[model samples]
Target: MTLNSNFREAYRQAQSQDVIGPNVIPKALPFVGGGLILTALGVYGGLGVISNYPNAFMPSFWVALIAEIVLFFVARNVAEKGNNATATPILATYSLLSGYTLSAIILVALSTSGVGLPGIGIAAGGCGITFIAARQIGSNLSDRDGMALAQTVQLGLIALIVVLLGQLLFSLFGIYTPGWLEFAISGIGVVIFAGMAVVDFYIMPRSYKDEQYLSAALGMYLTYINLFIFILRLLIAINGGGRD
Candidate 1:
């Protein structure tokens, strides 16, 4: 079946159902936990590889980024089709590949004087708080309101993509960015992704059935990863400003 049809069916089921079918959180936790563990392993392995062959970092990052993009789309397709068996492994692969890409940034932060531990700590703490608050807000939202929030988040995500594309182009052309502008952009990213996380969390229980745990887990995992990246970037910007 087409992706649209899959979504429509899921929506219909959500609208018709009253009780949140079997606690999704319990089933989802294992996938989330396992994905995170793999991600950590990937990141540490990436760091080691990069340290041993400094020149490979850029190439490795690009390769991992491309792999992640492909795997993400595949995983989404599988999950939307309710193929949890296929989706689970694909999601795990995407998470690991993402960690490989992220290791480059982590290395940069570590190399920067006085920006290592403190920046990581702040970003991790911020993500934790954001996740908890988002869960509370999502759980309280009615189904209709949660759907509305999801639409708003979709638009926000599109705008964020455009902004990120612009940044990429500017960087490609070696355009000089003001310190404040860089900070502002990163701050905006953090806010947008945090909001997206809230929407994702809110919609899972409302939109997905209990058996669609893989789909729900994938959505949450993506949000968490993006949130961490944005928060890390924001901290890095703050640290850079302090130095300047």
Candidate 2:
């Protein structure tokens, strides 16, 4: 499981050969811009529950989840079909979904008790780091060597284990896993997802032909989705689900 070699090679490939089209820039810029825009809207929509209709805030959680699911398929289909134009919209939809999901989790934290300052701080810090990483990945207007075959296979297995463990833990407790355990799980999830981003970034350009740009967007979307979900779980862990 190695990334250094493949990642460097991918970089060289980009430098020596034009793997992307001119429309890649035009298509990708909007993905970045639109992602940011939707993120802002989702954040506002989810967190705007400072007063008035507090109960109104709850539905946004489901809305965000459903939106993510929809966009996932849309992006997958577009890439399958070689439609680069759909890239920006797909990214935008996923970004909004992420912002909305985070907003819901933050609301959950506020609604619950016993979370305290330390928990909030840790969650916030992790989330900030994840956000920055997302930006770095999205702005990767170029590609290069990617994860080795071993690393790619390992990441897939790790992701599967993490997801299964998370589900089992949740089912057992009827909620998120408790305390530092949750944070550890989430932290690992973030790292794995980040690795997936690098792998996907390289895979898109190297594997797909006409759909290179769209595939890039899809890879970036998956990265964000995995990162945000794990980070949200980490926050829930710190919060301790109040008295429940």
Candidate 3:
């Protein structure tokens, strides 16, 4: 079946089911909170380790990135199959690793230019505001509307992927990226991730069981991290690239 059709079926199924007591949001909050805490700890720990042993950056980045990817898929699969016990730990680990990766990027930007901290602040504020607005908008959307928004966001993501690949190819060819192009790509990333956050929030109410809150939190956390990274890059670009 087509993606839209599949969405419709899921929506229908969700609508038909009798929702039990204790809403998904409340159940999800603790997991999300815990994940955020772990993320902060990971970022701090990574920064400390990287500061003391600068040589470890590349290895740590690769290891964290790879481990996070693996754990995310495993956790998602387990969550979908209703194995919350296993999924929760995996999700937590993924979040922690993600934070570590983020710290590396932040530190790199800081070392490169003075815009780093300001960029981070702006990104955090933007993410907070966007998330709140998106959640409100999502909570008010009908399932059909939510599905439509999801499709639109998916298309945006495809465009973002294209931009990313183009940038990668440019880098591989040792071509100099124009400042305008860097700014544009980063802007697109920010917008796409923001839209994705909205869609994610919109679908969450109907997507998972209360017991699967960890999975839901994981989704939100991913969106937030992506948004932060894009925003940070955009800010750095505005400040004239990350170069001393």
The best candidate in terms of lDDT: 3
Clashing pairs for predicted structure model 2, backbone only? 6-145, 6-146, 7-145, 9-145, 10-144, 10-145, 11-144, 11-145
Residues 1-244 of candidate 3 have per-residue lDDT tens digits of 0011123333344554434323676677678778878887888888988889889877988888888777877877787677888888887887788788778767756764657667677778999899889878877777678777877777776677677777778779887568777788789888878887777666666777777676667667777777878888888778777422
Ranking by lDDT: 3, 1, 2
Cα lDDT, all candidates:
0.71, 0.54, 0.72
Worst 10 residues of 3 by lDDT: 1-10
Off by over 4 Å in 2: 1-30, 49-51, 86-91, 108-169, 172-176, 228-244
Q: Write the per-residue lDDT of candidate 1 for residues 62-101, one digit (tens) a residue.
A: 8888888778778877876778988888888877887787
Q: What lDDT would candidate 2 get against the real structure?
A: 0.54
Please give, for residues 1-244, the per-residue lDDT of candidate 2 as tens digits: 0012122333334444444553443354346446656775876677776345678756756766777767766765675567666655675667777677666555666665655345545654664575466446634634323334325535554565756667677779777444666566666766666665545444445444544555545444445545555655556665565223
| lDDT at residue 237 of model 2 (Cα atoms) | 62
Model 1 gets an lDDT of 0.71
Where model 1 places Cα greater than 4 Å from the true spot, the runs are: 1-22, 241-244
TM-score of each: 0.85, 0.61, 0.84
lDDT of 3: 0.72
